[model samples]
Target: MKFPQYFSLLIVSSLLFACSNESDSDTEKSGIPAVITPVPLDTYFPPITRTDEWETVSIETLGWNENQVDNLYTYLEDNDTDAFIILKDGRIVIEKYFGDFTKDDNHAWNSAGKNLTSMLTGIAQQEEFLSITDATSQYLGEGWSSLTIDQELSITIKNQLTMTTGLDYNVEDAFCTDPECLIYLNDIGTTWYYHNAPYTLLDDVIANATNTDFNSYFSEKIKEPIGMQGLFIKVGYNNVFFSTARSMARFGLLNLNQGTWDDTPILLDTAYFNSMTNSSQDLNLSYGYLYWLNGKSSYRVPGSEVEFTGSLIPNAPADLYAGLGKNDQKLYMVPSLDLVIVRMGSASSEIQLGPSGFDNELWGLINEIIQ
Candidate 1:
């Protein structure tokens, strides 16, 4: 959903590469090319002047089933969902808050907020504050990690963005930010693991590079501009974001429009936007900068070394990409349908860091309604 134009550009480049390599007849494709259905650019971005003035559309108007509405809510409520929303062309088709949770109540994004950090990094890079290729120590300074100067210097922002920093995950606490906890596992870029220490350090890198606090920079660049009402809180070693469900949907809308808020270009670096949402590393085809991509040939989930052999969510759209959190918080977008879906709540039962069994089960239920 982030880049329809980039995928169009990719198709052109891929055709050239596919023809040039006689050896790459079948297995060596650059990207999974698909005919992206045109997203409706006429969609409205909710104004910040009145935060409560978002537009709405009915599912019946979109030819979705009314009978299944009850089924959808039933599943959401039964599974401990606090809020759920489905947007078509930036207009709400369904928005519901369960139990004591209201539309304005704040819920933690957990790991889904990693998408917010990824976007801010892109914005920072576009403004020339930093480059992803630069050694992380350039900002974090030497000895930020237990690695030697040379070893630490070998790690780049791109490595951290792609989860290929080769940081040790076999620790007593993977979330620990101390230098002693960041032991070197393999050579930089040679291994891929979802180690949080390297990722959490990205806040320091952004703060040092931009000469601004991460939260301040985020507010100035993204939150205030797009009418988003959210704040990042330092929780232990991580900076987790919290916002109302509607604010989360606003971000989903922004991403659906390729990092734009109406006519204003919030993140106009098309190349960086493309890279942020597409495959950033070969080791995990389903991961972008911090987003979970779908429709790739294979994908590896968090905390697991084994690679699964299919799309991340089999019941969902092939082009769906998402920001998934530890407790089943989800932000999913499908460009073909001009759709953005967000779910924020407590975990269905246990805390899982996404691509969980609930994803398939929920999407299976959603399929019946959307169809």
Candidate 2:
């Protein structure tokens, strides 16, 4: 779900028009054009609700006094961190960025948007939009429904959420297209591949079930309630959304609070929180329902051996969950630390969505100060 750096501006322009035909005139009625205003890097720190909650600690306090966070800033500046913010104990702890990124700049969350969509699924199911147990074909109509007679019969919403749909991730046309496009590579529940097309179709499932567009539904149910002025961008996919790094942090903090937003039960199905944070697929123990898990020590790499290492913190509480995107756009929530750390920027690495060793390294550094 991560867009290339070249598309950042393109996405912003599209964001303004995302709801143009989608029945979201209220956004314009409120006088907020979908237009994105660029913000300077240094001024991107969002106003904290309560600054006293932030306990600033040096890298040394986190066991890396010699490891300057300023060095990290220098690296980000040389690279591209449009916007980044970190929260510890519900307060801003570290906020920094580079280039034109700012507090108000609405950067694309890419696949990280999937994590939000996954939560929306829980909400939809809670509202009885459709049960997770329903077969994918149930909502997808004839084209996708035909798969039942064939090998695709096993596919289900659960499989889609867990990414165990068993469809070949290699097919370009089918990979991106719906129903007619996807051919079962293996059987359902057999493989783990980052298949985008099937995941995108889940948007339609959600949309059809509720008789609403994904973006509007999400805003009314999740974003608006949490006070996050988020705009879900409609890219080539069916249900992609865009939000400021601050808005993204708001969602992560909601998860950090286990589905409660300011004492309100925005997500009625709070039981799904733990399941969303834990691995749902047997193939990749590090991934959950669109969210990445930090509790695992091994990662499967394509064309390479499985890499193994300890997690960020020894005996770290297993409740830490995250939404990760390309170029290192991250929303990390750790219930144990009562912390939500957000980093949005173009890192030096081109493939930012893989098993980013950076997560462990950065968390290790942050934990030094937390403990």
- Candidate 1 least-lDDT 10 residues: 32-41
**Model 1 misplaced stretches (Cα beyond 4 Å):** 1-41
How does each model score on TM-score?
0.88, 0.76
Worst 10 residues of 2 by lDDT: 38-47
Give each prediction's root-mean-square deviation over alpha carbons: 18.4, 20.1
What is the clash tally of candidate 2? 13
> Over the stretch 304-338, how does candidate 2's per-residue lDDT look in tens digits?
33444655334335667777766667787877766
Which tens-of-lDDT digit does each residue in 221-258 have in candidate 1? 99999888889998998889999998899899999999
The parts of candidate 2 lying over 4 Å away from their true place are 1-67, 145-150, 173-175, 301-318, 364-371
Candidate 1 pairs with clashing backbones:
none
